[model samples]
Target: MTLAPQPYLNTRVSAMSERLLTSDQIAALCELSLPDLAERFGLEALLDEQLDRRTKSRAVKQALINTLLDELRVLIRPMNATEAGLVLAWGRKYALFNLKTLLRGQLYELDQSEISANLYELPAHVRLPQQELFRAEGVLELLRKLEQGPYSLIARQGREVFEQKREPFALEAALDQRYYGEMVRRLLQVSNQDGNELKQLLGAVLDRVGLLWLLRFRFSYGLSPSETYYQLVPSVRLLHRDRLLRLVNLETFDEILAALPEPLTSRLAGSTSLMEVQRRLGGHVTDEARRTLANGQSGVARALAYLILREHGVLALFSIVQGQLLGLPRELIEIAVEVSEPNCPADSLADAA
Candidate 1:
């Protein structure tokens, strides 16, 4: 796993960490107007993006991701093939977002321009062939084209779920499940020796998303236990398969909260709302990633940790910038940045708005 010399990655990441905005710093920036914030923190790129009325939000979001991924390409240069593949799997989530958009567009028979509006201009290596895929006349055809490309497995799984359940929600869930399933495979490949390496770093993540998704799919969407269970990512220590299966049957938040195992139970005590639970869990994962980044381990774990924190930072930055540019209220601005859940593949900008 010692892919290459560690000094370069360590030094680069450590230096970049200093340059990243602290939570307090970001909070302080929220108090300033767009101009003042841009001048202060050198957010000229965001400022420039805001000037475009038509593509303001989309442009800024794409800018943040592109910058992050470009830096990732540099950081992962020293990694061995397997290590790089793991990082790429994580980074490719954005490109997959485009695939999600395509699927939804085809589902509704939306115009190509409208679909393209929501897609990100991902790094060339990760970018999907949108023009070709856009030619499909229906969701099934779109998926068929998708299967010929990098996301063949994800598309195939999505098709299976769609064919079985015949619902858009389940189709998107299947795609996410397959994506994470593939990610887990690559994660183990890099760190399966002792099963001790990324378990802690990624365990918090898997657990956090798994729990939150279980609550939402089982309750919010009212899917059956078996159906909701299929939508979740692979289980982790605290919320293993058995606990999640039982969790799916609970009738209320109180029952689910009471049934949770130790640590999670104590940590989430008195947390009645799913939002509160999500905020707490998200912060926990963020803290763990920070610790992993600072840990003196091999570059693989630290690099992964860097990407997690870096993604969080850029998103917070985007939330602040997007809110300020749009003249949204302070409360709205603050809430936008708080880590809750990842964007659902089925939701477009319109769906989010």
Candidate 2:
């Protein structure tokens, strides 16, 4: 189904985009103490009613995420089903996150309450079967339950990967591959200008994800070329199947970087560490989203651009809160909050929360 541009929705998204937090504002907020932060951000009521000061970082982060989701829900509420579907497609990432959490928690035998506590309370229309997932006895049982749901394909793939390797990384990687693949497939079904713009944005995202996965799997996880290739999302922009095969076969990170396409090579220059690579890629994505929001004609594209910015803002805040909770230096906190880096290590502030 084609999702035509809705002028009213586009205008509303543009207005909402204007209200998003600036990097400087986020930086300044990061410097404040919990009470000061609440007062400064006008979140005192939310803080007092929903969050404990002792675990302020997690509480504040979740509250911000919920606020973002609520805003997106309102923005899309007036649109027709097809237009709403286009916007909600982006939010599927959150559903995937919840599924991954449930699967991992089940695999590790974590308590259902603990898993549920970490899951986001998505809008009713987009919500997943959290209760059913939480009640599953094991990963196999969870997969069995999900096989007939929206996440059926991913569940099946994750189950296959788990059976083959019994490794969480492989399972998670498979889920990610499935998520991006489905995103691209769905975008292709929309034959319109907005669809093309969104495809470009998603293409860049896929490239970044592929590069990061390649580096981590080869260098960090010590996976072989074949194994690394197995984890990658099939052919996107910069790293198409041929290039990916070539890069995976490369011996060192330097060689792999050298083999990259022009824009990425230039963008990633001097990114000596994994964190640096992630930081640069995050900057690229942020810039792309802003460009789309400014120039995009389609309502879905503009709304998606706003959603990207909003999600990044929330993530930046999360990083700042994490740094603060960990008693990190202000300079370090600023660096962490400057970009929207995802899949942070388990020891990060967000994880602890």
Candidate 3:
């Protein structure tokens, strides 16, 4: 059955697209430190002007999450039963992310108070408890608590890995890939004939994600090719599953770089740094989505508009926080941030970094 068009959702998304920073605003942000920027501007104040919270970095993150949820609430509040169900399906992705983050925070033994501070309140579903999550005794109990969700497999694998005393990054990556894969599947089911563009954009998103995983896995932890490929979420345009499987056989970063597609080859333009590769891939994906949205298709167009705004806010926040945490120079961080688009070529970005 065809659902009615949601003009309100479209309008909110359009408004959000309008408020995103331009090249000039981004350039200006490049110069400010996190605290300095927080004091100088009220992020939500400039947009909704409804939030009364102080304009700190954490506040900005909270405000972004809240604003998105507020839009979702407004869109769904008037939805009929059937439409509301569809909306709920979309909203579950964010809820799943928060749930997994909570569980991982528990596994890592982060302080309960700190974990509570990190909770992203959602528009639906009761939140998992930070205290229970952190004190869950072991991974088994953690997985048991999360049995109600779709990511049970990740928690299960995490349990096995924990016994070996390895960091959970691989497990986390695998979980994300699986979740996003499933989300895409759901999207396709309801996407209608007009959703092909959205599907393509999603495919590109998966490709970028796979690229990041391959590079990070091979470089950061020095995992064997087989081990790295085993954890990869299985959809990418440029590299087949077998190629990544074979990538494990390559001995050096240069060899892996050589094996990447032409579009991703630019990732090798500068330094061979894995972190820089991540930043570049992010920028590349955002830029591609921005371009795709400009082409003006159907639901895809609106999704692209909101997705880009969401990603920009997130990437900007990550740059600010990571820079602040590492005490890196603002100049270096900005350079890294600039390459966050998917096409910028990781090599050049790394060289600049």
Candidate 4:
């Protein structure tokens, strides 16, 4: 008989529930510079203490990225099947993102060494040296290796785009939309329970991600309706593809905001930039998770909440560290960080209904 995996995920969920940082901790974090903040709060210690390196202050930019990868892998290592699946899904997306980064970085003739340094390595893949990556022979070979994995479709699409002398942005968008769309479909199909708050929270994230992509691609990147519509990953049922297409086709951002649905519209419409909109969207999603967890949806809510909490904490740490190294003001970092972390009321109404 095959041995069963340990049930320690529940124990971990309980532990995480306790450490869900208080509002005071967030306020304190908001007040400190990257270095001082890390040292004072032991954020620096997470790097040196947890991972055993100082994560040099001046190199905080790269260090933040590396630490995040390491920390996330550590967290995911012990999770149960469902819990691990959630993390794995997000990880695959980031891996896809890194692939896009490599393609763009190489195509733009960025230094091979610098490009290699920026890549995020998953436990599955072998790392490549930066110095040799620029040479066409090595780039193709790396892509060949990556092509054998989950990214085969994207690698194929990228090749076509490369041949056509077109940017891979559209292809990237399509891959994201397809992946998330499938995920949402699978989750809903498997979950017969109508009141699953975990599904609701995940749906909210999907909708927001789609909304952000639609808004950003349409406004910032100038994607047409077909392009924007085809690239959306609808992990949630809230958004209608037709509606998204219509919004992107609108003449102005104000008009687009005016047509948005309740709560989301109100939160996102206030932002003059995509970054601001993303911040509000992320906060609302976290709030939804907290609400779900409060209403007795332990397994799913616990899973979603943990992911949100981890992402928010790690990303904030990354931002502050990067901001300080860049000499950006604390205020700027705070504003930027807000996009990823929100100050939600811990006692908000439950989402079980």
TM-score of every model versus the real structure: 0.88, 0.87, 0.71, 0.73
Cα deviation at 185, candidate 3, in Å, is 3.3
Off by over 4 Å in 4: 1-8, 33-36, 40-83, 125-144, 160-165, 185-189, 192-195, 269-275, 296-298, 339-353
> What digit string (tens of lDDT, one per residue) describes model 1 on residues 1-353?
36333677777778777756667776776787867866765556556743674466666677778878998898788777777887788888888788888888878878878887888887776888788887877888778888886678888998877888878887887887887777777777765422354667777888888888877776666678887887777654567677788887888867888888876788788775677677778787888888888764666667777888888888888788878767888876766675223333322111110
Best by TM-score: 1
Minimum summed lDDT over a 10-residue window in model 3 is located at: 344-353
Clashing pairs in model 2, backbone N/Cα/C closer than 3 A = none
Stronger candidate by TM-score (2 vs 3): 2
Q: After superposition, how far is residue 125 of candidate 2 from its true place, in Å?
A: 3.0
Q: Candidates' lDDT values, in order?
A: 0.75, 0.75, 0.58, 0.58
- For residue 344, give model 2's deviation from the true position in Å: 19
lDDT of 3 by residue, 1-353 (tens): 23434455455556657656655676677766655665554453323345333333456666666666665555455444444443444455566576666766666777767766666765444244445556666656776666555445445555565456555664555456556555455555655533555555555666666767766666665677777887675553556577667766788767877777767777546545665666567667677667665554443335544555565765565566556546787666666566333434444223211
The runs of at least 3 residues in candidate 2 whose Cα sits more than 4 Å from the true structure, single-residue gaps closed, are: 1-5, 45-54, 78-83, 339-353
